[model samples]
Target: MDSSTTRTKMTVEEIVDALRDKIVVQELAPGVKLREIAVASEFGISRPRVREAFSILEERGLIERTHNQGAVVARQTAGQIEALFDVREVLEALAVRLATQNAPKGTWDVFRERFGPRAIKAIETNDMDYYVEAVNEFRRKTFQEANNEILSQSLDRLYDRTRVLIQRLVLMPGRAAAALEEHRQVIEAMIEGDAVRAEQLKRANIVSARRWFQDFKKFLL
Candidate 1:
């Protein structure tokens, strides 16, 4: 009798992703109950597998199982968002820096342009889909090429927590253009194999995002 969707066979990972996407985009807003039975039915999976997906989502801070409410979507406070940004700077800076040295040649040529003309058009048109995909692509590819399992694992969780915030960040006036340029510089550093420079640029970008989040708090919150 609870919420239901189309049923399909899916792996545990797929179930997690489907739920995560809904949560990130606010379809599964904070405090909404995620019934294990309902989700299991929707995904055509066993209850234990749904539990496994819930465990992963909880680890990513996207959900919490309350005393009586069971598992529900989680909401972040302003303080929590700031904390995520802090950890993100360190992890992502190291990620980009290491990617510079570890990524094969030409690893960044596509990204450099993605953050260029494609990003520009996306910003101009206010295409959130393209922006989101571009950002995810860069993060995914950068970590994959970074060749550091520990760093990648650390970042994977942090990225999930702050992913929506970054999406929200672009909505601030002029923030999208600023972010596009910042990403371009970071990509340039990676392309040149300037690890230190890449790291610094990435940190600067996070710093700017944090500052803007504070400055334009009303818009973002």
Candidate 2:
């Protein structure tokens, strides 16, 4: 690989993406120290750039800087996970309700088209990663249809902070299939323009996910 070609200028955003990917994929394990010099050398960037990325990651709740330890991946307790999901359930319930009230005709059609087949594929392959990605995509589309910029922005930040933990939890046995069914139900409610039912179903689905995570906490943490 050409050195210059492989070493493109990395903005703070790109650095954050790199670090986030590593954390999300568990390449950077929880509690692992992320030293600036090592990270900068590995990415072929300056230490300042690495520090910039670390700051963004810290803001996203993925890492924390300690006096002697530098930066380490943030750890989530079982109680914290439950609380996060509880908050997510309420927020998503509101989002679905708003979307149903204001969604354009066929607003959910894009979700049906994109997620329908991918969901089937996930079930057939039992691929937890793909299933989690699909579910996140569906939820994002649902929120987007609400057409509320403030809600979208707020939910986006919350999701970003908890997404890695969510992904890990979803990989437990039986969760992918259960989550697929829940997604279908959410879609059904949205399609029928039943805002009340949509909100209820969305909350139920998230609560179910929270329970699943709770049960699998030993395996996860």
Best by TM-score: 1
lDDT score for residue 3 of model 2:
34
Q: List the residue pairs that clash in candidate 1.
A: none
Cα lDDT for residue 211, candidate 1: 93
Candidates' lDDT values, in order? Answer: 0.86, 0.79
Query: Candidate 2 — worst ten consecutive residues by lDDT sum?
Result: 1-10
Could you give candidate 1's per-residue lDDT for residues 164-216 as a string of tens digits? 78888888898888888888899898898899999999999999999999998
Model 2: per-residue Cα lDDT at residue 10:
60
Per-residue accuracy of model 2 over 48-135 as CA lDDT, tens digit each: 7788888888887789997877999988777777777878898889999998888877877766655577777866787666666677
How close to the true structure is residue 44 of candidate 1, measured as C-alpha lDDT?
69
Cα lDDT over the full model 2 = 0.79
